[model samples]
Structure formats: structure tokens, C-alpha cells
Target chain A: MKTKKHENHTYIIESEDMERKNEMLLQYIKEKVNQLLQIMGTKPLRDEELNDESLIAIDPIGIIAESFEQVLDHLKESNRQLQLARDYLQAVFDTAGVGISIIDRDLKIIKCNEKQKELLVNGVSQIEGRHCYEVYCGIDSPPLICPAIETLEMERAVFLKEVTKKGKVFQIVTSPLRDRSGSISGVIEVSMDITEKKRALEAMCQSEKLAAVGQLAAGIAHELNNPLGNILGYAKLLLMEQDTTEFQKNRLEVIIEQAKRGSSIIKGLLEFSHQKMPVFERISLNACIELALRSLSDEIRSNNIEILTGLGTVPYVMADPKQMEQVIYNILLNAIQALEGKGGIVEIKSEALNGSVEVTIKDNGPGIPKEHLSRIFEPFFTTKPVGKGTGLGLSICAEILKKHSSNICVESEVGKGTKFSFRIMGGVTGNV
Target chain B: MADKSGINLDVINLDIRGQICPACLLISLKEINKHKGLLRDGEANLIVKTDHRDATRTIPDAAIAMGYAVFVEKKKGYYEITVGRKDEDQKA
Candidate 1:
């Protein structure tokens, strides 16, 4: 019996030693797992590590069980945070107003936001893994001035580029997307449609020009009126003299004619001096063009310039007849002057569109220079020499059309003819 | 009436004060021309004061060319030119 009791005590001591060793092994595994989790910046693995073939072969069963439970709790907490972060990022990308796109180093689009998807409807699903130029610009290769490739190569944010696609203007900015070690992995492109901003800027410029004209009108008119009054006074006084011979009467008539010419010039100056409030009416565009042509008929015929009319049968537009006349007249006069006595064809075409009317005035005169075409409608910008042009004709026409909720656009190629097309809203009824 | 009082109107009193130079006298003459009728009438007299003595000679010559009579008077070290009507009866 003494031998049996001693044997049982030995067994109990051995079992306690085994249990203590198992607890130490478990503590060591938990510490190692915590350290690894911190280093890897990943969620803690649960029974996965214990079940792993390499770990299971080295660790005891009891220690593996305890370490598994602790790791499971940590993994659950980490997973919850990761899910929250992922949801927040997805929400931001889904609802952002600016179109966002991610492209690889090869310029292939890897990811994109909802706005980007909205902008590209055709082949949008197939856009992924495709080159950005092929997908967005509908080109076989990237453009020469691509902002995305620049951002990647330079490894920094690049300036915004204005791009016109499908008649809509967009301001696109690109930045390099870096990896964990700050190495350039790809490019992040953001495109904002700035068409409205561009239109607003143009409108602001027009208003400023109008303000300047208003302030200078009084002074210019006063200066012009003095000379005009002198001419008219002397001409009338000569006409009223009774001793005027036939030869003298002819000279007097010439003086009167010259005075009237001066008066007309003053009228033009005065017209530019005031703030013009355009009156809108449902008027025929053909009549407007005819009146414009009539005003310039003598000049056109004298210059031997042929006028070609392609007036389309169109409905009348709700427009100010007088202002529209001015618009047409200004363009016609410019065309005549551009001919420079070496007459060319002036072709006028009018077409009624779905929501607007398009009037195109084309001249085969010496086309505007490439650099000057963009600033043709800018106030006080003229290619003509001093005393021959005021440089305000096209600008005034642009201002008038803009007041009527219209716009003037010019397309010209140097050495080729220039075309000026303007559109006016067809249904608008109120005066501007 | 011409010989009633033996007071010969040999010289007229013209005060041209606050005139700095010939340019200032010209500016003053322009302002005076704006009130041509008033100057033509004897009811008002031109009193021009100038800091420079040379303006006294220039103002009188300019006034005469514009058909006005002028006389210079020096007071308190300042030159004055009085511009009067060409004729007293011509006042309107």
C-alpha cells in the first residue's frame, strides 16, 4: 500500500509539470503572434496558425488551443475596423463629383469612380485594363500631352490641362499614386467639367468691355461733335449764300456730302458710347441678313466682291432685329474690309437647329493669323491698321449676341478662309 | 463829360494774385473766357495775383489779344493785373 501511494503522488507531480510547460508554450506563442501582427499590420490569425501544418507539428495541443482563442478575438476586432475603413473609402469614391480614375504605369485604367463611369458610357465595363487614351480619348495611343504619363514619370502632381471632349471642356489634374515605400505605382487622374466656368469668364470679360465703352462714350462723342459741327455749319452757310455759281454750287454740294460723311462717323462713335439694351422680337433672320447686306452693298460692289447667300428656309427666331442686324452688319463689314480691295466671296448661311439658329458668315479673304484668331473677339483687338478699324466691331457683335443668350465662335486656318458662326436661342422672347 | 474832372484815366488797376507762372496765367485766362460776358461788362473786374513778376507782362498781352483792357498794380510784394472791359459802354 505504501508503494501504491508513492507511485500515485509521482504521477500527479509529473502531470502538473506537463500542465505548467503547456501554459508557458501558449504564452510564448501569443506574444509571437502579437509581435507578428504589429509588424505585418494585418489582422491576427485565429486557429488558422494552430491548424497550419508547420505550427501544428512544432506546438503542443493545449498551448495551440489557448493561443487560438486569444488570436480569434484580436482578429475579429481588426476585421471590424478594416471593414469600416473600406466602407468609408467606397462611399467617398462612389459619391465624389469629380471624375476620378486610376491608371497603371502602362497608362491602362485600373479603377475609376462613378462620375468617370457616367462620363464614358460606351465600353465602360471594358474600360478596365485598357489604355486611358483608347478608352477615354478614343485613340489608339496616348496623346502627346497626356497628364497621366507625366505624373507617373515625374513622380509628382502635374498641372491641370484643359481638354475638350464631345464639345464639353474639362479641367483634368493628375497626381502620382505611390506604393507603401513611396515609389510611384500608378497615376490618379481627376477631371472636372469647367464648361460653365469658361462661359462665365467670357461673360465677365464682355461686361467689363461694355463698362469701359460706357465711360469713354461721353468724352469721345464730345470730341467728335465739335469737328462735325464745324463742318456742317460752314457747309450750310455756303449753301445759303445767294451768289453761288453753278461751279461753286457743285463745290458746296461736295462740302455738304463730306460733312454728312463726318456726321455718319460721329453716329458710329456715339453708338459705341452708350450702354445698349437689346430689344428682342420674333424676327426673320433672312430680313436681318438682307438689311446688313444692303448697308454694305455699295462697298461690296465698289470692291467687286461677290456676295453668296445660302439662306435656309427657317422659322423666325426670337431675337432683337436691330441688334441682330448689327451683328450681321459687323461681320459683313469685317469681311469687306478683310478683302482689302482685292475682293473675295462673302458667303452667308443660316440654319434653324433644334434649340437654336446657326448663322455662318464665311469670307475667302486673307485668313486671320493663327495667333490672332483666338483674340479676334477681344475688345480693342484688331488686325487692321489705325484709322481704318476701331477694333471694336467684332467685340460689340459678340457682346450683343451674348446679351441675347447667344455665343459667337470662330474657326479659321491661316492661308485658308475664316468662318464665324453664332447661335441664338430660338424660343427666348424677352429683351436683353 | 469828358473834361468834367481833370482825372486822366492813364492807368488801370489790375490785380493778378495766386498766379505762379505763365502756365498759371494761361489757365486763368481760359477760366476767364468761360465767363466772357461777365468780363465784357464793367460790372465785374479781373483781379489776378501772381507769385512771379513775369506773369504780369504775359497776362496783359494775352488779355489784349482777347480784346480786353488790362492794367498791372504791385502791392505787398505781389503783382496784380486788373482786367477791365474794352469800353465801359460796351458792357452787356
Candidate 2:
């Protein structure tokens, strides 16, 4: 208001005020625009860039608003891509075959896949946030050997070949889950169900043991035969001398009888070590069973026991008739002897399955003890009293089945019953 | 659209070589606005060749704020700032 324009220039002073006021408004506009740009994260505008007349026409707010829309759009797109990646990882985690679980530092289950839940808990509902040991072994606290604990302590991966829980076997691998700074934060555990593999391994070990034992028994029998033959020949010659006294004759008779018993036992051992020659001929296992039952009819009747037979329509198995009949008779006689005093019932079933004939004989007599089940097929392993069994009955049965490229399995529960089952091929036996 | 190499592209060249900060930023923004549709659709690239080193920073900052993919390259006598849509794998 007080300027040189007012010095003897009062007439033009109002226009000067207007001019000054216009400059002030332009400056305000520039300030406001630059402020907007600063908020939008960009550099301030300069004076020479745009004339005051065209400043508002540029629509800087609209330009920045549109640009912000792009920025927001980019952020949303980034979020969408991240969600896609997360979903892909979740799908992979859920679909993996191995049981997978993530546990926190305190041994709490942070996450568990369906496979893991199925394996450990048999798919119990809502296991997350629970203690890992509680879910895995159904116990309150961690067991003596825990993979997650070891992984966290060692800060590395640990693999356990076989771990038994709930009577089933598992192979577990645990790795440390580390934080960004490479410090162990938790554990990621993976488990594979190896119960069947463990069973197969055990069966293989049993087979190898039996094979070695058979070889040893064969060698022993071969060595004992010559000496036993000499003993029997000399005993017979002394008895035939005709000058021996009654006491000497009686002693020699006892010796001959005992030698014969020893020879019979040795014969059984040799048969168990190597099965008798089985002529591979087409034979009806059903007929073999019937024949064996008829021969054991008197014994079965005298024992006051009932015999049940369920013979299905089966193909002729490629097995020798005599050997197959002997197997059936031996297995049946064992069952009858087991049920002699108990007068229990015996059920026999036969069926065709998987290009082979299967036979199962179940007895209601006292079941074989658990301790003796595995050794029952071993030669000279019997619970029968002395002079009753040579312990080679079941062993010979096992050897015969082995020669036929099969095996006889026995399932027993003490005081309940015992079941013996085996399979024989009906067509040409191509492979063992 | 097709250049000498027969690739589908329309290059909008902005030579802001002796200018510094605010002016460099304003000029790059104007070019981006002028070809907003094509650049956003990945059909055009606003290639700014600048001699001032500050333009390399200011121009790319503004261009990226508008959701344009930016790549800064140092040439013999100038810096080339390429801005476009992130529609393809590209490097300056």
C-alpha cells in the first residue's frame, strides 16, 4: 500500500494494488501446487516451468491423482502375485506324500499336513498348537528320542532310519527351521511310514537265519550218519554172536533201540535241512486234504473232536500228490495232537486266489506261544514232551513249502487259537 | 510402431541433456503424460537422454511413481532413462 507508486501517483495506485494482489495469488497457487507435488513424493515445481496464466489449466492435482491410482494399482497387483505364490506353496505342502510337520521352539506343532495327521494321529481333528510328542506318540511329554529336539539342539538335519511308535515303524527326518539371521527358530519334521518295509526286512533276516541253521544241521547230520551206522552194525553183530549172556543181550537190545531212535531223529533232521524230492505234477490239494483227514479220522474220533472242511472249487496245483498229501497230514496231525485233550474244533478252508490255491487250517486248541511262533519252523524246536515229538514236523512242512517256492505262515494268540496258511501255484510255477 | 529391427515399439525420445533437477523431472513427466496411453499399454517407451546426473534420479523417481517401469543406463556423454509399462522382460 505504501510504495513509490503512491508518490504523486495516486491515480495508478489502485491498479498497482491489483497487480500486487495478482502476484500474491500466483505465488499462493504455486505454493499450493508444490505442496501437493511434495505430498505425492516428487520434486517441487520451478517458476520458469509454467506461466501463471496456464498454471491451473495444467490440472496438476488430476495428474498426480491419476498417477497415485497407478501406484495403488501396482501395489494391488503385487499383492495378488504374492497371494498366488502363497497358494501354490500351500498346494504343494498339502499334496506331498510324506508326512510333514512344523514345530515351534517350545516343541509345539505350528502346522501339520494331512499326511502327517493321518500317520501319527490317524487323522485326529485339531492337533495344531499341541505338543508334538502328545500328538505323535500319544504321550504327555517328549520321548527319550525326539527328532525335533535333536534338530533344534544341533541346528542341522537329522535322519532316523527306523523309529517304532504304537507298534508301527516310521522313518523320520528333522531339519532346523532358521530365522533370517541364520538362528534356529524351530524344526521341520518329515516322516515316512515304513512298517511294511520293516516287516519285510525282518522276514528276510528270519529267512537268512533259517537258511544258515539248515546248512549247519545238514553238515551235522552228514557227519553223524557214518558213526551212527558203525555203532548199529557192531551192536547187531554182538547180538548175533550167540554166546552173549542174557544181561549183555538185554543191554545190547536197549542199545540197538536207542541207536534206532537216534537214527530216526537224524533222518528227520536231514529231511528238514533239504526237503524230499517233490515231483512237480498237477494235483488236487482238495483231494490231498480229504485223504489226510480220512487217515486221521480214527485219531480225531478218539480225541472227541469235530472236523470242519470248506473246500472251494480250485485249480489243480503244480505239486506232487504224495508230498502235498504228507504236508496236509503232518499239519493236521499237529493240530489234532494240540487238541487231543481239549477236544476242540478244527476248521479247514481252501480257495483259489491270485492264480494260486490257498489253504488255511484253524484250530480251536491252545494257541502256540508267542515266544515259540518264529522258532516253530526251525528244526528240533518243539514244545512237545520227550518221546512225543522230534520237533521236525513243522520244520519239514516249512522245507516242503520252500521247495514249492512258497511258505507256511502261522498266526497264534495264546489261549485263543492258531491258524496255519499257505499258497500253492495252480499253473506252471515260473518263479519262487 | 516397428523400428529397424521390426520389433513392435514406439520410442518417444526426450533429449534433456544440459538441464538439472526440477526441469529434468518436469520434462520427463510431460513426455510421460503425452504418451500415457501407449506407455501404460507397453506400446511405447519414453527414452530420456540427459547429461545432468540428477535427471537420472529425478526422472526415474517420477516415472516409477506413475507405475511406469524405469531403467537407467549410463551412455558415453549422457544418461539414458527408459520408462514404460512392465509388460515384458526388459533391461537398459
Candidate 3:
């Protein structure tokens, strides 16, 4: 007999270890035979050579080993599934368009996704483990009314709110991250960039205010028309009476001139506030522009401002022909005024782009200052001196364009030039 | 002919202070038209007391159109508008 120890396990086998492979098989058979002897309904059988071709009875040890293997396989499958779920959640967090961040009760960021990093840091630095205020507001401390703090204190979710920080607008929604027992542990903050939306809302509000003022102007103008008309009529009548003295005649002349001025002012007011129900028809934009220019032909000629047109074959737009002509006339007049008699080129261009007909009026003159651009559409807001302009021309243009479901946008640079562009959606069927 | 002086006694005065536009002008015009016969005869003058600034313009303009000479005097708290027909001023 030979004995050997390897890897802390003792092996008893035939001297040639390869020939003793069936030693465990013999032990398995012995255990089975002993079990059969204990059962009253079984008959004991003699043991013979146990070869690969011979079938051995099922053993208790073999059953235990098979069960153990199945349990291990199930654990591996569960681990693989759990790993897949984690990867899927991570992908969603990273690719979400809105900014998302997780912060601890200390207001320190624990985790943040790509959009959060881009919005807060402008893609400059990784923001994890830093203070939330420093990343978001560029401040040392969070404001007292911070939504994250509010959520933590209330232990509930906070609704989305618009917040302006660092000259940008964000819509913030905060929720309390709680433990299993419902105790708040941290906060999850989601934010979306809303600066453009905020600007549009402000523009809409300004338009509404201008509309109200325009309506008031129209009402006042209508009321004054009667008295103003009477004044002019009577002044003319008095002047025609062949009065005795020239003094009365001079007074009458003055009265007549002032009354005419008042009438013109009323005319401007009516133009600004008049909201006629639009009679929609497909009209040629190029024809309207040419007509508006023809009406201002005298001013254009006297001022020596060149009228250049690039009227491409644009499809007709759905609009009231009369009102749309007014819009074109106002823009062209504005361009001429910007020239200020310096004799520059006023270029008009119309084309079809992206399912809309766009008309652009460009002037090579002293451009409007940047600050005044935003308020140019407001009624009575003017750069012209008193008695020169009623300041309602552009506003009336805006009102008409708004009725057509369009908007006017201006781009200008001081000392360079200015361009005003408006788009009217093209009508279906291409022509009337 | 014009009376550059001011409103004196013997003129019919209608006070319209605290009344807002259009309304003030309406009432003032009504009074002036009521005295049309006397005004044409050079026997009566019409004066209106109104605080509405717009009435100062509207009333005078309306009166002048009806063959009357109008004068506006801005007082301490309101405007005093006096109107007389051209014939009355000529007689005075």
C-alpha cells in the first residue's frame, strides 16, 4: 500500500491511482444495497462487476449533487438579469434631454447626468460631490427659497417652477428621495431650459398690452372725429363769409390748420387700432409689395432712395389683400425713414422657404440701436421727434401680421444696417 | 370779432366738474344748443365749468362750428369755457 497527500485531501485508491476510479462507485453501490436490505418489500440481490455497460441503481448522494447544481444555475441567471436592469436604467439617466441630479441632505450633489453637467457647467467640469448652489446658481449658498430645500423640509414633491439664474431661465421640479421607512434622505432635482419660452411669453404679454392701447386710441379717435370735423367745416365756413377784418381770417386759418392736424392724428389712431375681420384670399405678395411701393413712389423718388426688388416667383399667401398691403407699406416706410434722406438702397426680397412665403425689407442706413429693437412694435414707441411720426405704423403692421398668424422679426447693428423679415404661411392649392 | 376779456356776469354758467369726457362734452353742447335762440339774438352767453381736459378742446371746437366764438380760461381747479355767437360778439 502507498499513501500520498495533495492539496489537503487524502486519497485511498489502488497503488495505480487511475485504476481506482471506481472506488467511490463501489461505496455508492454498498450504500444502496444496505438501504434495500432495510426495506421490508425489497429482496436483496448479489453484487457483480459494475462496468460502464451495467446499470447501477439510483444513489442518494447522486440525487443531492443534482439538486445542488440546479440551485447554482438559478443564482447565476438571477445575477445576470439584475446586471441587465442596472445597465438599462443607467442608459436612460445619461441620455435624458432634461437635466437630472441627485443631491444629499447637505445640498451636495451625489450624482448628475450628462445634460445636467452641460447645463450647470456649460460642459466645463464634472459637478459631482460639489455644492448644488455653486453648480447651478454660481453662488456660495443656496437661496432660502430653494426648491430642493423646500422639498426636504416638506418631505413631499415640489411642482415645477420657473427660476432665473445667471441670465438663463430654468423650470425646476424637485422631489424628496426617501428611505424604505419614508424618511427623506435626499432630493432628486429635474430642470429644463425655458429661456426661449420665457421670452415668447413676455413678447405675447407685450403684444396684448399694445393691442389694448390701440383699441383705446381707436375709440378716442372715432369720438373726436365728429367734433374735429365740425371744427374744420366751421372754420372753412367762417373764412368764406367775407368777414370785415383780416384778423378773424388769420385766426380762422390757424384753426383750420390745427383741426387738420388733429384729423390726421385721428387717422393714425384708427389705422393702429382698426381690427377688421380678415377676408382670407390667396393674393400675390409681389403685387402687393409693388403696389405699396407705387403708392410711396413720390417719397422714394424725392428722397433718392433706390428701390431694389428680388421678387422671386413666390406662391400666394393666405391673407387680406388690403391689410397685407398695409403691412408691406409700413415696413417699406420704416426702411425709408431709417435712411433719413441720406439716399441709400432699400432692398425688398420675397421667396418661398420651409412652407412659408418670406418677405424681407433691408435698408442700408443708420441701423436701429439694439436696445430699441425689442420695443419697436409697441404703439407710440418711436425714435422720431414729435410731430414727425405718430409711432403707430410698426405697431399696426405687427397687429395685421399677428392676425395672419405671422410674426415680424428685426435684426440690426448700429452703423451697419437693419433688416426686417416676416413670414406668411403659404396657401394650399398654390393660387386663387 | 373776439372778446379777449373774460367771463363776466349775465352769462349762463353750467358747471360740469368731475364729469368724464364725452359725457361732459355732451352736456355742455346740449346747454349751448339750448340757448341757441338767445345766443343768435345777442341776448345771452354760455359758460361751462369742466375739469376734463379733453372737454376743453372738444367743447370749444364744437361751439365754434355752430357759429359761436369760443374762449378757454384755465382756472385754479378747472377750465371755464365761454361761448358766444359771432353776431353777439360783433354787437358787444
TM-score of each: 0.53, 0.61, 0.49
Candidate 2's error at A236, in angstroms? Answer: 6.5
lDDT of 2 by residue, B1-92 (tens): 11111123588787777665565665566567667788878777878888878777766776676667899999999898988887567652
Roughly what TM-score does model 2 have, to 2 decimal places?
0.61
Candidate 2 residues lying further than 4 Å off, grouped into runs, are A1-59, A76-80, A83-87, A178-185, A198-224, A232-269, A272-409, A414-432, B1-92
- Can you write out model 3's per-residue Cα lDDT over A1-432, one digit (the tens) per residue? 456667334454434464565667766665564353223112232344223332243232243233234334445655797899988988999999988999999999999998887776764476888899888877898887788999988888897677766667898999999889978899999989898988999888886887787778876889999999999998899898965379989998989998998888788788776667779987888889989999999989888899999998788888899998989999999889888888999999999887778999999998999779878988888998776677888988888888899989899999889999999999555642
User: Which residue window of length 10 is worst by lDDT in model 3 chain B?
Assistant: B1-10
Give the clashing residue pairs of candidate 2, or none.
Answer: none
Candidate 2 vs. truth: CA RMSD? 8.8
lDDT of 2 by residue, A232-296 (tens): 99999999997999999999998888888888888777766775678988778999999999988
lDDT of 1 by residue, A26-84 (tens): 66775675454333222334454443452444333333233334335446756897999
Q: What is the TM-score of chain A alone in each candidate?
A: 0.61, 0.64, 0.57
Q: Which ranges in model 1 have alpha carbons more than 4 Å from their true place? A: A1-63, A69-81, A103-109, A117-156, A161-178, A182-186, A228-269, A278-289, A309-324, A348-375, A385-387, A402-432, B1-92
* Residue A219 lDDT, candidate 1, scale 0-100: 73
Predictions in order: lDDT: 0.72, 0.80, 0.76
C-alpha-based local distance difference test score of model 3:
0.76
Model 2 chain A: which ten-residue window has the lowest total lDDT?
A: A2-11
- Candidate with top DockQ is 2
